[model samples]
Target: MASTIISKDKFQFTDTIREHLAFGIVLTCLFLFLTSAYTKIEEHDRFMNGLLKVAFISHYAWLISWTVPVAEIVVSLFLIIPKTHKWGLYGFIGLMMVFTIYIGSMLLWSEKLPCHCNLLIEKLSWGEHVVFNLAFVGLAAFALWLIKNNQYKSLIKQNDKY
Candidate 1:
């Protein structure tokens, strides 16, 4: 009878799995941003009016009404291209963080909850909206970590060869 020892480096399934998971997360975020942007564009008047109802940003409603959708579209484009995917994830995380903070502020300080979100997101309550945005932010951040970790590991392996 022969005994075989398995070394850690001999198995790379974890790396492959992590890469796939990161890709899946990026794709999900891309879909979400693109859909949200499309909805805002399609219902521009309604979204702008909703933005106007929020007291803090009501003054800048005109600017934000256009900027939000445009930002979302641009971020989605970044996610679509492989070269810019990492930056897209960072953009996604930043946008989601801002959105989550906005929702939290609305919940804490505002008398009325005003949501200028897309169709599906519009259905969520203020608290649920906060949770939802935070969840995306977390997922995007995690995907970014995984990507960076994988890159670091690859660099280490390349260095070891020399």
Candidate 2:
């Protein structure tokens, strides 16, 4: 019998699987943001109300509630193109982290947690929302790592051709 060893960086993903996973991560984020943007825009006042419960002040909450949807739309657009995908992923990760913190805080500190207005996430309990956001964070991180490694591999190949 022969024993084989796999490298840690591979994470058991073949090149094709890695590629698919990367695309899936990007697309999933894009879909999530696009749909969320639409819902937020459609239910703008409700979103503001939800934020008001979470935020310390109403005006600041209003501002955030408005800006968040626009940001989501922009991030979704940027994520589709290869040139902007890295930055999009970075933004996605940051946003997810912020959401995770916000949800976690709501669960811990807030006496009355605000209901979310987004489609799927809106319905989830705070703990479930945290888990969902954390999952996205992991996906974004993995996508980033995969993209960087692919670039590194390409660069090495180019050097070898010299």
**Candidate 2: worst 10 consecutive residues by lDDT?**
1-10
Tens digits of per-residue lDDT for model 1 on 15-67? 88889999999999999999999998998998889888888899999899889
| lDDT of each residue in 54-145, candidate 2, tens digit only | 64546698779878898888888789887999899999998878778877777887888777557967778778788888988998999999
lDDT of 2 at 75: 85
Deviation in angstroms for 8 in model 1?
Answer: 8.7
The whole-model lDDT of each prediction reads 0.88, 0.82
Clashing pairs in 1: none
What's model 2's lDDT at 102? Answer: 74
- Which candidate ranks first by lDDT, i.e. highest? 1
Q: How many backbone collisions does model 1 have? A: 0
